[model samples]
Target chain A: MRIWHGLLIALGLGVAGGLYITAPAPLDAGFASDHTADTEAGALVFAAAGCASCHTAPDGASEGPQVLAGGHAFASDFGTFYAPNISPDPASGIGAWDLPTFARAVTKGVSPDGAHYYPAFPYASYQNMTDADVADLFAYMQTLPASAQPNQPHDVGFPFNIRRGLGLWKVAFMPDGYVTPAPDDPVLARGRYLAEGLAHCAECHTPRNAVGALLTDQWMAGAPNPSGKGRVPNITPAALDWSESDLIEYFTSGFTPDYDSAGGEMVEVIENLSQLPEADRAALAAYVAALPPIPSP
Target chain B: MKRIFGLSLATCALAAAAFAGSHANPALEGAVKARNAQMSVIAYHTGLLGGMAKGDVPYDAATAVAAAENLASAAAMKRAVLWIEGTEQGAVAGSRAKAEIWSDAAGFEEKAVALEAASSAMITAAGTDLDALRAAMADVGGSCGACHKAYRGPKN
Candidate 1:
């Protein structure tokens, strides 16, 4: 009996040791310290990243920057995730968070307290963003009006609610690089950055496996709408039959080639894209038009 | 014999009008067709004006005026009857209207009224100048968007 007790104690220690080694860690200090935060550039990055679409209140009735009170609920198979108040309010928002903490949260999907964030935040795509862009986004977020709304807790079921389990998910999914080979053309490169990095379009456009890992093999062939019931269309060159000009027009006006305007979550996406420069929209159109056509799953 | 033929043609015209007006509480299949036809009319006029607004087609003053008038007429049509109570997503396939339309009848009517107001403004401004047309276009788009976001389903 004593020998068995000793063996169980050894087994417990080994498990604990394995967990400690695999736990998600914050980025090393002094990493990306060279890129200075520019509030002006950050503003554009903030718009491209569509931070306000999720962070803003659901009704979003308020005009200007007052809408970032963050009560939007994203319902998924995992559970409903209430976007946290990202406003600059020191008490209830990220007002007190420093740049490094923000970077870690944005890229590594880890909170300042070392808790793992659910993939619902789309940090997997954001992980591809440049350090400069991340710094700029943090700087721009600081300039927004602070809201005192309290952060809402997620409504995940047990076992899944264990944030530590996400550390293993990060190991399987999280990485800092492009999903596909980098394009040689400058316009394509910019388009790739906007689609894959700041915009995180794949978070919705790409279908996921049973365990919720993205099916990278299919890429942007589209998936069931993450927010609800309908299927998001495949934007690969073969499936999306829009001309480059048609895409730019749709981005600018939200009208499809069929004259039907975009609805649902795409309404917000179009609203954000409309705020970008005409050139940026064109770049996006050009890049999307160039994508290798993948058959829809 | 000619008089009899004329009487039959007149009867057919009256019958068609009655069929169009009686679209309220239509059978499930008929409701989808009626609503889709109504939306198609709206889209047709919207496309004409949209083509001019985006400069995709030449901005002819006469064409702009005609399109704007057609749109206003379409918006003013008493077609709300076509949105039968049971003709939403689950009850009928291929219809993107949500059940919220019936549940929130007052809200839906308010949006319809907003569309009328926007279309009225477009009719007033469409032939005046390019700038006026552009401003009115924004209002029309916004009104359509307001209704769609609340009542329509995601595109398939």
Candidate 2:
């Protein structure tokens, strides 16, 4: 019996090792030598993701919460997960991460150390980022002055804390590669990238199932969050009353079609988006305006 | 240009009607009306900002300063007064707006205070040079978000 058990363990290890070896080789790419463009692109991504809102401490407060000095807590069904610092700090942040590792985390949900990240980081949407865009983003991040604050350990409980379980989740839900714009439909392709990559609209719009998995088929249809408090509204073109130009304007300036202001999380998104180049903001509006007016469930 | 336009009111009325039609709560209607009024002010300011951004209007320091002051005043209505405290928490559609804003009164007040503080700074800075204006705008913009991070409904 003992011999058989030992053989089973060895077989399992071999299979896991085999799977790792067969996986696609992480792509090798780098930002163009033009420092200016890379930095500009980086700023855009930062705004799109609203990185500063969560990462930074509130105003007049000492140093803005360590730039990338992640310690923000997100309460969810599985457990509480504290955000980790992604600054270029060698000791705490991703300072030592190679380009591919950063790409993998942003686009593939896998960290440089081979650990799986919780969806709170929104890599699912980020999976649509193009390689060139990711390269530029990586370079931009590298340029930020490093933050030395150490990471905050997640308060997640057992089972959820097991990194191996995330492997199963990834296999089931993770998109295999970045979204490529279809040649036939530039609008859709652009929308797909903006929605799926930069905006990560579904993170808040789509409802999660019992295990906290996103109900992808529902798409932007509204769903209740773990908070069990307020429900995220249905944002498919159908539910929204704003026109494309109006939506674009709102995103750029935070004004609703009725000229009433959007508050809360949207305000931050608007703030972040306001800083983006106008072209990108327009593209996002174009794509969102084109979504099927999916009815609320 | 402070003249009332009926389009927003019409839209809000339509939206209210669509939500529950004639039988809706008068209190909720009143609240929505108040919210709409404040939002209109924000919209008006946004229009001025648009003109400034496009260089359609001259970037006169005085007018720019006035526009910025209008923005600050418009933002000042006690946020708690605008939307009835608990109305958003019980919304039917899946909304990420938390009940915490009402339950944890102190925290909610803090968010409002933060927004107010930032808005004030923006008003002070708007009449300055373009670079200064942009930086102040960024701060003002960021203040609007800082509060939203904890309180507002998620972007659909």
Candidate 3:
């Protein structure tokens, strides 16, 4: 009985120690600290990342610059995660956060309060962003019109609602560096960075496991839409045989080889892609063309 | 009595769908045929413009002007015969139209008006220069997406 008590105490200590190590830690400022903000270049990052796709208020002003007021609901197997107000509003948005806080949240999934953000934010992919790009993006986002729209509380339930538990999830699932190998070709390398990091094509295109970690083995093979309505089409070289030019054209105009126009959420995706330079679209196509083909599931 | 009335109305719809499928009812199918023709005309002109926009075909002023004018004419076509009660996605074979076209008539008309507006703008832009044509193509694509996202269903 004394031995059993000793064993139980040891087990408890180990569990506590484990939790301590996995606690959310904000990233070191590193290169981001010395970098100067270039708001102009940040616009390129904003368009490539489709920051407006999930951040912009669907009902907000649409004509000129879109208001990134952030009430968009992202429904998932875990729960519906409403986007927080990211506008430059001092009170309601990220206006109070400095470049370091924004960088930590964007790249490390750690909040300003040092709490773990739910992976729904896609920092898993964003974690690969260059320090320069993060600084630039932060500078650009600060210039957008601010809205007083309050952030919506997420509808996550039960175990998922325990935000602290996500600390362990992150320790286990957070990948190191780019998921795909760095390529020698400069164009393919740019394509890989844009596709895997800023664009987060994997968030939708790559299937996830039961716990919502991306199935890296089946990269870009596509998956069931989180909405449960339809399948997101596979774009792996195995399934998508579109020429690089064809892919670029589709990105530019939303027209398929079949002459059918894009639909659903992809309409906005194409719109965002259309805003990019033609070279960027060409790079994305080149990156996709280089992916190891995974047969569609 | 309400259930009986609903059942008979459903039966009447099924009959219309059968004709829509087989083209036996010329009156109803004629409307479908006319709608399909207009869409084909739109597609043809769009392809012509797309080729020039992509530089697959050299951008000639006359061809660009003609294509844009044809697109505007097609967009402004009177189609009182199209979009009757029965020919929707699940109701008729090969029909990708959604029930929203009838359920929200004003929204449908708004999309048609938007298409006309877009094509009209395309006319002025198309013959100006390649850059202008490229700029116009984006809006035309957006207008197509706007309606399809609301009123079109997936392929069979």
lDDT of each: 0.81, 0.66, 0.84
Q: Against the true structure, what is model 2's DockQ?
A: 0.18
Off by over 4 Å in 1: A1-17, A28-40, B1-35, B51-62, B76-95, B113-142, B154-156
lDDT of 3 by residue, B1-156 (tens): 967865765566567666557555554555667777888898889888888887789998889999999999998997444666676777555578899998997988988898899899999899899999988887888888878888998764
Give each prediction's DockQ, rounded to 2 decimals: 0.27, 0.18, 0.46
Please tell me the TM-score of chain A for candidate 3: 0.96
User: lDDT per residue, candidate 1, B17-135, as tens digits?
Assistant: 45656454335557688777877887888888777766678777788889888888888777444665556775566788888887897888888898899888888788887767866
The CAPRI category of model 2 is incorrect
**Residue clash pairs of candidate 2:** A57-A65, A230-B95, A231-B94, A231-B95, A232-B94, A232-B95, A260-B39, A264-B148, A264-B152
Which candidate wins on DockQ? 3
- Provide the lDDT at A216 for model 1: 85
TM-score of each: 0.81, 0.67, 0.88
Q: Sort every candidate by DockQ, greatest first.
A: 3, 1, 2
lDDT of 2: 0.66
- Candidate 2 TM-score restricted to chain A: 0.83
What shift in Å separates residue A53 of candidate 2 from its native position after superposition? Answer: 3.7
Q: After superposition, how far is residue A281 of candidate 2 from its true place, in Å?
A: 1.4
Score residue B48 of candidate 2 by CA lDDT: 67
lDDT per residue (tens digit) for residues A1-297 in model 1: 999999999999989976985587868677678987899898888888999889998876635674578989989888899999999998889888888889999998888888889999989989888999999988889999888989899999977798888888777765456787888999889988898888888888888987688888888999998667779889998699988877876776677777687777777777778778878888888888988899999
Instruction: State the TM-score for model 2.
Output: 0.67
